[model samples]
Target: QAGTALLLLVAVVVAALPAPSLGWGVDGHLIICQIAQGRLSDAAAKAVNELLPSGAGGNLSSLCSWADRVRFRYHWSAPLHFIDVPDNVCSYSYDRDCKDEEGVKGRCVAGAINNYTSQLLTYGSSSLSPSSKSSDNLTEALLFLSHFMGDIHQPLHCGFASDRGGNTIDVHWYRRKTVLHHVWDVSIIQTAEKDYYDEGAGEFVDALNKNITGAWSDKVQEWEECAKNQTACPDKYGSESITAACDSAYKGVTEDSTLSDEYFGSRLPVVNLRLAQGGVRLAATLNRIFGQSKA
Candidate 1:
């Protein structure tokens, strides 16, 4: 009965926040691919290997699919919020002044860091006792860390604090009722599926690396800029503004419209950049935790 209730709760959350049908479909694959590139140091490899089986045979493509499933279940909606709050105007509000509100915590970066630290501490504690060491728990923690790191890099994930990251800002994704945040999470990526990098994991990692090298600092800057100039930021206010900004961000990339080309063309660079950062950072975190050397 306890297990059944937990399953029901998970179902409700997944339904309320449908997993983004983003191009990769599975994110774990991306993380594993990054790991296999041999770019990571020996320590990182040992850490990841400790979590997986000894001789799990498969190329990058197959491994990636496996990783995606593991990551999705563990952290599919982890990007939604660092700290859950009650449903209220403030929940959906992005007003700068709300930063001081009792449950509010700056932005997604701070939230992601907090969540990562908490999970790691919990895992450390559990691993201390032989009876408490569960393979499932460690795997889930690694997957969550992998996914959340990726989430913080996503501009929309950081989101406007006022509107519950655009949850309250209702809009349409081809006639379906969706929020601004949802569109960014799934719609845009779905639209890019046609051009997705479906080749080997190495190729995917290489492509992602090129983008990440350029965009990491820029994304951090964008977040900081948003934090500083809350009012001047276009998407920091009302629903219309949120919708318009999202639409513009994903216009061409996710839809077949005149706005498609420019929109898709522009953001593609940013997407690559974020993915790259996710892959490298995932490797870095694993190294630190597992005592691996820098790759």
Candidate 2:
């Protein structure tokens, strides 16, 4: 009886623990990169091929989650994955919202984007010095850009300060108890039935690329215009996300905090929008960095 009781107690403790994951889950990131790849200029395509494994056949999506996979080896880089705005504020300012875990300023996701973008430029210009010996490899800069673009658009990555980007807000995904961040990270896409999409992430991304028409393609110009302007990029994307987190992602919930079709109905479109924008913006950055002029 004591053994059985102890087992029950252990299960209770385990069930209450929090599991934190970063950036869009593997699939979301993949889809974002795949979309970006399809839109890349021919010169950018050649540059990407030089950076990634030829065995992978120049697929940028293959490197989409490289930052997350190497986090332990690059411990300081973990904070570069997200930014937290205060409870009511939606916009991101480098000085205000880009602090790391140690309270040092300008170390968050937005700053990472800026820092890595400069590193990427080293490949384009003869006069520019690489950001660091650590980031000397253009591949790392490209990978970081690929990942951070997706991170910036995840509403919860740009979510509230109190929750560490929704890592604390407990919510049930149908029957499984999980945090709000995970819901956004993995659930929104994975929960869909396979009839509508493939369960395999690479395949799912292919589907998204094949099905994505030119509807949002023209919007790339505006996204690039805002992103290129340092004062506007993070502020625009981060603010838009947190505003949605407040208005849609976390808006309706009782003590139960159950996520049903009503919740998905509202937030999924937001997810879809972010995925589109991230891809478009990433392509724009690559084009500017690796276009024929640079090559």
Candidate 3:
């Protein structure tokens, strides 16, 4: 009787947990936000510091995953974390691809990015300064922007609808059984940290920062630039993600395919590149938005 009761308790606990993880893991979000906050302009930095919750201690990265944590409470936001395009489609279209399962327009990650970006833009406006009076919540906007920026960069976040961004595709990370989405979102980053960075994300961040300024220096400007001077360019980012998904993420293997050293080795560079671009573009967007805005 005790054994059966314990099994029931276990099932209850498992049922309560969030299923099918989305976006980058805690470490991935942290790394991206840390890199971004480091590159914030003086004006942007002041604004960010002013907006961050008191508990964050002026560290944006600390609250980078707040959106995910509140998904259950904010049920409407679940759809905003990802976009699902048709299976075997290698490209993304804003009008066609950026919508929720119910076919609501502007409900996907890219749209959410643009929406939150617009909300955060009101930060310095005199009429918008009083958070209590303003209809928009800049704090939540900042947190959502930071989190969704990381999400839209993850290749699988833009993966096929049939697979729920690879969430349904079961695969093995070496010897561990897990879904492909989790592989990209967490497993790969965790492996990199363990194998090369002394199990520290800070070291991994430092290494990527070095590449950003060193080998990847020439590409940084292109990554940060939005055509026609938009405050944020999520459409471009979404397009890049879907392309990368086809190129690197869903390139090979089938259901239950074992993603071992070969898969890990080749895909790690893609992961690094995406992470680098996410951080750089986030900082650039914030700089443009908060430029000359008094804190």
Top lDDT prediction, candidate number: 3
Off by over 4 Å in 2: 1-19, 124-135, 193-195, 200-220, 227-232, 292-295
Worst 10 residues of 1 by lDDT: 229-238
Among residues 3 or more apart in sequence or in different chains, the pairs in candidate 2 whose N, CA or C atoms overlap within 3 Å are none
Task: Please write out the lDDT profile of model 3 over residues 1-295, one tens digit for every residue.
Answer: 9999999999899778756597899999999999999999999999899999999999999999999989878999999999888999988998999988889999999999999888887776855556545578899999999999999999999989998989989999999999999999999999999999999989999999999999999999999999997999998888889999999998896899999999999999999999999999899989988983554
With candidate 3 superimposed using the best TM-score fit, by how many Å does residue 7's alpha carbon deviate from the native? 16
Alpha carbon lDDT of residue 289, candidate 1? 51
Candidate 2, residues 1-295, lDDT tens digits: the string is 9999999998889667543478888888988898899888988888788878666777889889888888867988898888888876766666777897679987888888877777776665544544433437778888998899889889889877888888888899888898888888889888752435656666665545544555555565676665344422655777778777888777875335989778877777777777877887788777877763373
> Taking the tens digit of each residue's C-alpha lDDT, what string does model 1 give over 209-272?
5544554545533322334522112223122223333544433332222334555567655555
Model with the higher lDDT, candidate 1 or 3? 3
Q: Report lDDT (CA) for all predictions.
A: 0.45, 0.77, 0.92
Error of 2 at 198 (Å): 3.8
Clash number by candidate, in order: 15, 0, 0
Model 3 poorest ten-residue lDDT run: 126-135
Candidate 2 local lDDT, residue 294:
71
List runs of model 3 lying over 4 Å from the truth: 1-18, 127-133, 292-295
